[model samples]
Target: MDRDLFRTVKQGTRNQARLLYHRLVCRLPHLLAVTLLLVVAPRLVSTLSLAALWSEARANAAVLLAACAGCAAAAYAYAMSRPRPVYLVDLAGYKPGPAHEATRAQAIRQFGLAGGFDDESMSFQKRMMERSGLGEATHFPASLMSIPVDMCLQTARDESEAVVFGVVDELLAKTGVRAEDIGVVIANSSLYSPTPSFVSLIVNRYRLRHDVVSHNLSGMGCSAGIIAIDLAKHLLQVHPDTYALVVSTENITLNAYLGNNRPMLVTNTLFRVGGAAVLLSNRRQERARAKYQLIHTVRTHRGASDRSYGCVTQEEDDAGHVGVSLSKELMSVAGEALRTNITTLGPLVLPLSEQLRFLATVVLKRVFRADVKPHIPDFTLALDHFCIHAGGRGVLDELERSLKLSAWHMEPSRMTLYRFGNTSSSSLWYELAYCEAKGRIKKGDRVWQIAFGSGFKCNSAVWKALRAVDAVAVGDTGSPWAQDVDVLPVHVPKVVPIDDDEASYKTAAA
Candidate 1:
């Protein structure tokens, strides 16, 4: 048995070596170029130094100079060919009125009675909501509990229009940019779309120019905001001096599951109505007025793996009620996705010290076959602020542990989850608003926003603050957290018990 195990291990090592060799062979051109510069170039120069070859020295010098010039031009072109700078000129988050705020008791009573959940399902949802870390102020659309169930469309429309119109108007007004000047309009929503599409609605409502390019992304879950930003960045690269308006939102009313499946039930407890609008410009003149400059965007998708692909998915339950389900392995899957994303992002943003340390560990393990644990780079050193996804309490806890982050570093995510629950793709913007409302973001500060979504995907966006923004400047009308900004960073208990009569009755029935 011992001999067989040793043989298996040796075979695995050989296979890995073969794979590495194939990869290196694919990069042979780059390796050959590097070898010419380091090895052949110096030897050629030295050989030309002999006085016997003085006559040929001038030709060799010209050849060497030409090679050097070619290399410099290639490097310059690679740098200049990169996408143009995309600036976040201004942004706004939708603030729902008091009528939309739903407390735990309210959700328990309203959803429990209206959703027609069985006693066991109600009990399970009650427990889930208690541990959700959401406050009593999370908003919900009025159409969520319509008696006839036919009002879902109207509810979705009302909710989407309110959020889209409010945030876009606020963004345009704040940036002083005309609607007609927006060259690109991208809107993403995880649920519900009217015939004209959300992007079309924005164009019509704002009277945007006929030539404005527009796209409406549907079914891309909570990470769609960053994905939209990535799309806009690419568009700006091709279309110079253009403005891209990205609206990220999720409509909960139509997507809300009225089923008994525990996984589906969790969505109803966590997701709430919210939206955000971000104005991105590639025009150089807008840089001085911009609030933040987009620096890096890294996205990782693990959909090929069955476990990750099914981690979060929308499917019909046994009774034919359709809803998005959160799998038991969601946290683990999300952690893996985040690891993949940061692995790519670390080299781009991490300081030299951290990069060297990570490189040393990787070299030791790969080349020396050292039995060393892989090091998680100190991302805090690379970013001043972190807006991790507010997917749920467990998601936040896992990220904190994986990234070795402190409580203060996680304040924005925590507070956003507490105030807004999981607003899907727009949650990161809400967290950013919270940071801004608290005056935590300073000029030149690097803010890193990470999001995990249904594709078992992790996406990250890094921004450098262009100018200082004071908390006072973030008024109640400007930010969803503005009204209670001063009272934030508050202690949110892990569990808030439901004390309403309905909850008591449900407990008695159970």
Candidate 2:
């Protein structure tokens, strides 16, 4: 009892100290100004008296006071003109219920029986999944294999509703923020949209206010999550004291590639069912309760280049089988996109020393025409954590090499891919949840989330944690990895052979 009381007292004291520090930091400019005035007031008065210029001194003092008043007014105006702080109050990832779980063997069996693929296609898909870095536990719709091409509407609606409702409901429940309070709604899904649109569906389902602004984004691919956040940030900046809800997801059932085109088949093996809903607020009242502050968002589009634009394209193959084809040039295009994105984001987040070095390298390369390669500023110097999109094994490997991230740093992306597969835009959120579940995030730590998408686009969102958060306290039960998080970072082999019967069947059919 005595030890418990002592511990409580110590914690209270620490909390008080933290409060005091925040107060001082917020009022630092005012404190400095007051200190300067106190230090100089006496000397100024003495000097004026010694000069025997009382009348002139009084006149000068009046002018000086007027100037100070003008300056204060200007400062207040500038402060008001600045954008309000945007906070991520809370976020939730949709973990499809047990009914949707698809084992690798199940996926193979269903594909075989569905008659969507020939022997060659089946073998290729099996090979792709084996090397795809996705585990047997990845979620897929029960109707995926059974849904006919003409009945795509059912699959689209079912998948969209399941993910959208699951994530938004969880987010609202966690934050206790009513749907009516959400003034802006932005929903992004690469493949599916009905007449009402996904955003309208959300607003209608949640019974949001009549005035709620809604937008539905499509064709934005895997990076759409960051893009949606960027859109929300802008909307919140323009409309003050309002809540914005951003939902990122992809309709895998509707977009699933069933064609024999090898490039297009890749998407089938990579993408899985997932979605994330994030609640952002610019309200001053919620600052203390918010989990993270949006520090920076940068987006770059290299679509002007023909190769970059064509790297990831959705179209019908020669046989009229529609699918998204990922070209071999995707990695190189993505690398260029990332390089361009980081160039814009570096100045805002990178340390002064790193910036100076990068600037020097640029100068040498451009001005002197030297054989100097431009430096990639060490992003680790600016961010405590990185949530790179878990698009695929090759994407993760390339990013790990490009960013100079260690195995420990790349663990979240790798593990998220293994657990959930590529959830399109929402993949970053799953990666972030992985970090949180592992207890890697801490107060004041800055996390950088970077994503690449089908527009030949790369985008980034940097977040600073507002307060300490424990994975347990946040309740990880809703996460796909919640049950097995403790046993994660497990070795996933580069390839796993298909069952002996399935292999023989494929060989005979060929």
Candidate 3:
């Protein structure tokens, strides 16, 4: 009883101290501002005194007029050069029908029937599926799910076209935007970059304008989605009064590895059928209708280093079967890339107090050569929501620890993973859709979307909600989370921590 009382008292004391410190940090900038004003007010008063400045001002009146005119001209030029704000009008994430769902038991049974994998490889996949944070309802491409599997260029096209059409049709329906009105079209698919690229396919199907600026990004990996968004943002800035359509997906049909190579099998269990289409408009009139406004984007690439470059590579194995190899160094490279990205992003989004703290840490380490640990900025203070890529369970687990995010902040990512597995480049969008479905996004809420992929690139897109995103009706055909999101915030079984050797393998796979 005495020990319990002491523990309670100590916990209360710690909570109070934490609260007090947070309040102080919140007000530090204001305190500093007041101090600065007090210090500078005397000098300003003396300089602006009529007696002191009257003679100087009259003597330099002509010079002052010329300086004012020059300043005005410079301001005008700067304003003209500023980029237009990109508004995310709306987005649609493709929801696969009931026929596409890949239940866990069914997947394992099919894996055994398909053959080629050794007993060890078979067990590896079984274990991975059990702890992969993917639920039974996640969809796989119909072509690949067949007992014998039919993976061909035609099947790949079938999968890609279905995803593209599903999301784009839903997006157009909700936004009431005509395909002809789309001035820019950008499509990204890491693998299966077919002839009539995704951009060309979208343009031809929608009968988009002949002059539409189109870009097809291939082999950019999962991070390519945000990279597409960043590209669209820049295009919208330069090409005023236009709508940009960004399509992100990964076609698993042709990329699935049939060999017994353990490292390559990771992709088979993780990736699934998913895609997302986003509509961005630079038109001033769309601001009222837009769901969110693009605030900032930061991308970090570590591919220059040999280790990072070789971390994720598509190559033929010794047996002559082609697949994307997962190197053990992948997680290490990703961590470095993430660090570089968030460091660049911190100043752009972190609050004044957090910025000052981060700045102090930098100065102490770089300038003063102090031994203090580098401070991890409190990103939660800056961002109201976080949508980290749902690559795998370990990826989400590591990020949750690194960022000190609460379970609530991670729910969307976790739920998305459970529901969709890893949709590669399109996973981040599905996570965002989850937030929208839950109505967790309020006006002025800041959201951070971060993803890393092949080329060892880490990318972030920051968005500010323009208005409260209305919660979705259960089973809305437009959303991937339609069937089960209402039942979500579902209980995901926690993965047991693995040994070092297994951990590295899982990390690289993630």
Measured by TM-score, the strongest candidate is 2
lDDT of 1 by residue, 320-395 (tens): 9989988899887887687667766776777778866765766686679788766678989879999988999998
- Cα lDDT of model 2 by residue, 15-88, tens digit: 44665586687678778879999999888887777556767767699887888999999789869867789999
- Those runs of model 2 whose alpha carbons end farther than 4 Å from true positions after fitting are 1-47, 50-72, 145-151, 359-374, 473-478, 500-510
The candidate with the higher lDDT, 1 or 2, is 1
lDDT score at residue 445, model 1, on the 0-100 scale: 97
The pairs that clash in candidate 2 are none
- Model 3 lDDT-worst window of ten: 496-505
Reference-based lDDT, residue 4, model 3: 32
Q: Model 2, 187: alpha-carbon shift in Å?
A: 0.5
- Write the residue-wise lDDT of candidate 3 on 1-510 in tens digits: 335323433443454466568668766756986999899989978768776577777899999999899978976876676678999999999888889987776676566656566667767877888789988788888897786788889989999999999999999998999999999999999988998789989988999999999999999999999999999998987888999999999998888887888789888788889999999999999999999999999888888889988889998877887888889877778877887777667756777688567557666866787887656779998899999999888889989988889999999999988989899989889999999988899999999999989988999999999999888888577676676767889878776322224333333233
Clashing pairs in model 1?
A: none
Instruction: List runs of model 1 lying over 4 Å from the truth.
Output: 1-82, 145-151, 362-372, 473-475, 501-510
Shift in Å, residue 269, candidate 3:
1.2
